[model samples]
Target chain A: MTDIRAKLRGFVLEELVYCEDPDTFSDDEDLLEAGLDSLGIMRLIMFAEREFGITLPDTEIEPDMVRNFNALTGWIESHRQ
Target chain B: MQLLEDFLANLSSHPRSCCLVEGGLRLSYREVAEKAGGVARQLLTLTLPEGYPVAVALPRGIDATCAVLGILASGRCYLPLDLKAPRLRQRWILEDSRAVAVIGHAPWNDLTLPWITIDTISPTPLEPLPLEMENLAAILYTSGSTGTPKGVALSHRAIHAFSDWAKELVSLGPEDRIAAIAPLHFDLSTFDLFSSLSSGASIHFLPEGLTIAPSHLTAWLSDTAITGFYSVPSLLSFWSWKGNLSASPLPDLRFLLFAGETFPTARLRQLAGYLPHTRLYNLYGPTETNVCCHWPVERETLDSDHPIPIGYPACGDRLYIAPRHNELWVQGPTLASGYWQQGQLHPFLNEEGWYQTGDRVGRNDQGEYVYRGRLDRMLKVSGHRVEPAEIEAALLSLPQVIECAVVGIEDWEGIRPAAAVVMQQDEAIPTIRALLKRTLPTYMLPSTIRRLDSLPRLSNGKPDLVSIQAILTR
Candidate 1:
């Protein structure tokens, strides 16, 4: 779980977000509010699929599924084969 | 005349016909008319000037639609404000337009303008005010090369001409269910709102944030049975790339119109393969002139790797190429009146009534207008018009550093604004970004910020944009 969270956070901070400080961004911080726009969200999904080798369903790409680092980890875990 | 006439005709001819669909809620033409009439009655009470600008700060939905219609009915210019934009930017637009009142659900106590809550008012029997064709209909704000945004004041005649042309071009009818995907602030929404409503077609308002989820967006289009759609190429490309467009073939989608940015030939070919039944069109124009040129994509043209032509003139617009520079100049009925700045109408058109579009064009052997590029430094980042100067101005406003240069960094995804700055003290990327967030919208915010020793200068002492772009790319 920590591995998944760390990977998700690393990718988001490196690519998806430019405003938030990675070291200070809490696990529960809202990614959307941190300037993760629609394009960023799309790129994040692609990155997660390639990194984890899991097919995240398009219908399941809701705000609740990827709102925060913890939520992103749980979503990836559920989709893991 | 087309807007008011068609709206009245639709109301009388098909009172019970479904006019708007958002989520599970469906509003008929009669219901929409009643709600809009209520809003109009409330505006009539104020007795503002004939063409006073009224801002609509509400989110995109049934209420926003009714508010716009009510503003038009009351013979006032409707100014749609982006609710998600930075508060300071919104305040700037409000001050520039000198809006007499705001029609919204929530009370904007900080804005000192008259706030008219549409829901609180009751529906009353009323008729639309007799407005002339030259009267202002809407004012759309776009990123200016200067620091502030410029408002393009569109007249009723312009809206009438464009909507009429769009209605005929798509052969829109009562049975067509159009998707209102673009926000009200975007120029594309004018077609979705005016063309759909005027033609008696039903419009489905896609919920906010649904655009972020490509798969869900595709599913929503299929579930809603949307027959017509208009949007920017960025969103369509994103949907085609990741939204599983091949798996979910939207049969109900008849015509797809894309504009605001160039659509890559390869991505467009893939999209064509995914949706073979739908017709694709490339619309071209700035907010100053609504859809001056358009090209219907033929399968044969997609075989080549070259960019598609913007094709023939649209909306009764005449295209002219300047001799010295290949800049495209447009003269048409759909031309906006002028720019609304400092509560004054400043005419942008030349003496001959031709608006010089900053875009460069070349005529093909077939005499079709081929888009070359923009003559100016303006960049279309994700279908949003962005001026590097605007971002640079915002960055310079912050006392953090010395000089800065902003440029568009183009990757496989699309072009995005990136900045290189020389700072007196070392500042974190997040700090600069946080300061910029107060003034710039999320799209205008630079995706990448790199601290530089100094920006490369040319022989004339101007910042060398090519070298800066290379640095950002590296």
Candidate 2:
């Protein structure tokens, strides 16, 4: 689970949040307000699914599920078979 | 409805009919008319000029709709400011438009303009103000190449003509429910708001943040039973790529209208497969000219990988192609009156009354106008029109930035703005980006910024954009 959180943080910092410094981004920071647009969200979902070998349910794709690093890691962990 | 005033007047006959839906809130024609009338009465007390501009800065909801209708009812042109846009850009527009007042929830404390809070206004239905067809209706701002945003000033006549055409083309009726997915500032909302209201159709305003979630958006479309859908091709493409459209077919959707950017043939074909019963149209136009040409997607035309043609003219518009460069020119009632800049109205149409759309096109064997490319360096990033010059200007505003070149970088999603900057110090990149965020919208911001010692220039000392694009990609 810790490894999964690290990977998600790295992907978001490098791809989604372009202007934010990775060192300063808190674990609970709102990704949506940090410029995670629709395109970025779509790409992030795809990346998570591919990286974790788990399918994130489309119906659960709400703001709360991917609001931060902890929420994203938890969502992915629950879906992993 | 021939005039915008007629839309509200005709609503009296269907007083009990549904007019707008946002989330769990639903408004009838009578309720909407009364609220909008209250807004008009508030504006009338101020005694503004006949065609004075009023800025509307509010979230996308029922109140925003009422504010626009109220402004229109007051016989003043409404300038919609996207609340999600950068504050500095919104301020620039408000300053440039010379708005007399802002109809919003809270007072714009920074600006000295009068604010009319919507919730505080009491309902007092008033008759629509008497106005001529030539009176100004709305002013929409777009990215400009000269560093400042250009305001497309449209008259009531232009909107009526386009809405009449749209209403007839889609056969919109009182039973139809249209989705207002586009932002209020975008020209696409013209069809969603004006055409639907004129046709006595109910428009459902998709809540903010729902647009980013494709699955949720698809579910909403199905749950709401939306019959008429209009948006940019990029959004539809994204939904089709990720949303569960195949599993949950929208049987009630009668028409799907897409404009703004070119739709990839493959993605469009996939959409057709998913929504076999729905009609698809490729609408083509700039903000200067509201939907001049469109093509009804044919089953046979999707056989090849090539893009679809822009098809024949609509809205009583005539197309003229420049012989030398094949640039498309439009002349019709739908063309905007002119551009408003720095408190001056500059005529956009030529002496002969032809608006030159900076789009290049060629005639196919079937006489259809095939879209070739843009005649200028404007980049369409996910259906948002971005002028590289605007981004370059924002970069050059910083003191440390000596030179810069902004270009489009194509990736899996689509084209995005990328910049190559030659600055005195590399440490200023973050600060420069932060400053730019205050002036430009998120879509207009450069996706990648790289510092270079110098920009590649041509023999004439102009930046070689081709080389710059190669370097940015490499």
Candidate 3:
């Protein structure tokens, strides 16, 4: 689980370009408030789906569920095929 | 010619028809007209001089729309300011326009001008004020290179000319329900508001929260049964990339019109494939000209990798291509009154009344006018114009900043403002960003902030743009 969280954090910072530092974001902090817009959210979803072979539906990824790093990871884990 | 007058006539004819849908409220033409009349009556009570600007600093909703119409009904131009915009930017607009009064529900205390509440205004029977077609109707502000917002003053005749041509071209009617995607302050909203209102059609305001949320935006489109829509290319690109448009096909959507920035070909193709039934158009113009040209995107044009042509001039507009570089110059009744700075006609306007559009164009293989790019240093980031100098000036104002220069950095995604600062050695990127957020809008804020010993200088002692670009690119 820790390995998955770290990988997600790295993907979000470097690939998705959410923010400069992975450390800037806490596990439970809201990503949207931390400068992640809808476009960024889309990038996250796409990146997770491509890298982890998950089929994350756009309709299912509510803003509330993707509130933070942990919530995003939780969604990704449950949705992974 | 008289746009406001014609709109009032349309309102009276369709008094009981649904005119505006916003905030869980459906307001009919009668209700809207009465509310606008109340605003007009309250505005008259102020006894401001006719033709003076009345700033409407309200949130986007039915009330804001009524406030603007009321200002027009009272024989004065309305200057709509987005309440969510930075207070500094809003203040600059209020001061620059020299507005007589402000009317809105938003609480702003910085203004010396009198304020009127929109919801509390009492209704009164107002006689039609004799407003001329050539008289000023609205002033929309765009980002300026000099760190100040430049107001584009547009007249009633200009908007009427453009919107009439637009309505006829789209075949808009009372049965159509248009989605208001752009904010009231942006020039694109003019067509969304006037075209629908003039044709006795309904306008459904896309709530502010839904604008950035693509999924929500698509959901709203389905729920509202919006037949017509107008927006910038960036939003459409967002929807194409993320909104899952294929899964949620909008059966009621008839057409989608876009402007303000170049739509990426990949996303355009994606959206086209997703929505095969909807007609698509690329409308092009600066805020000054107000929808002077349009291009209907056909299947062949959509398949190409090249940027779509902006197409020919709309009715009542004359386009001149200068021999020097095929620079686009426009002359028409649709041209804006002038820039609001110093109350004089813009320097871009010639004695012959032709406004030089600063946009350079070239003919594609098919003889269509293809957009080359802007002749100026202005950059469009997500449809909002960002002048690097504006961000640099804000950075320099910070006490810790010694020197700074901003430049546009374009990559695969799009252009973003990047800053190279010669601040105190201890200052960091996050610190500079935090300081800038207080004054600049999020779009205007620089994406990349780098500390530098000093900005690269040319032989002329000016900041070397080429060198800076090389460094930023590297």
Question: By lDDT, who's the top model here?
Answer: 1
Give the C-alpha lDDT of model 3: 0.79
Candidate rank order under DockQ: 1, 2, 3
lDDT of 2 at B169: 89
After TM-score superposition, the amount by which residue B397's alpha carbon in candidate 2 deviates from its true location, in angstroms, is 0.9
Worst 10 residues of 2 chain B by lDDT: B1-10
Candidate maximizing DockQ = 1
Can you tell me which runs of candidate 2 are displaced by over 4 Å? A1-11, A18-20, A46-57, A74-81, B426-428
DockQ values of all predictions: 0.51, 0.46, 0.28
In candidate 3, stretches whose alpha carbon ends up further than 4 angstroms from where it belongs are A1-56, A65-73, A76-81, B49-51, B342-347
- Across B1-474, the per-residue lDDT of candidate 1 in tens digits comes to 636778789999999999988888999999988889888989988867554699998888899999998888888889999877898999999998888999988787677888998779687654898878999989988899987798999999998888889889989999999999888889899899989988899999998787888888888889989998899988888788767787899999999999999999988988888899998989999989989899999977788889989999999999999987899999999999999997778999888879999899999998889999888889997788999999999999999869999988998778889999998776777788778888988889887888998899999999999999999999
Clash-forming residue pairs, model 3: none
Please say which candidate is ahead in DockQ: 1 or 2.
Answer: 1
Model 1 has a DockQ score of 0.51
RMSD of each: 1.9, 2.0, 2.9
The DockQ value obtained for model 2 is 0.46
RMSD of 1: 1.9
Predicted structure 1, TM vs. truth: 0.95
Residue B52, model 3, lDDT: 65
Superposed Cα deviation of residue B94, candidate 1 (Å): 0.4
Model 3 residue B264 CA deviation in Å: 1.1
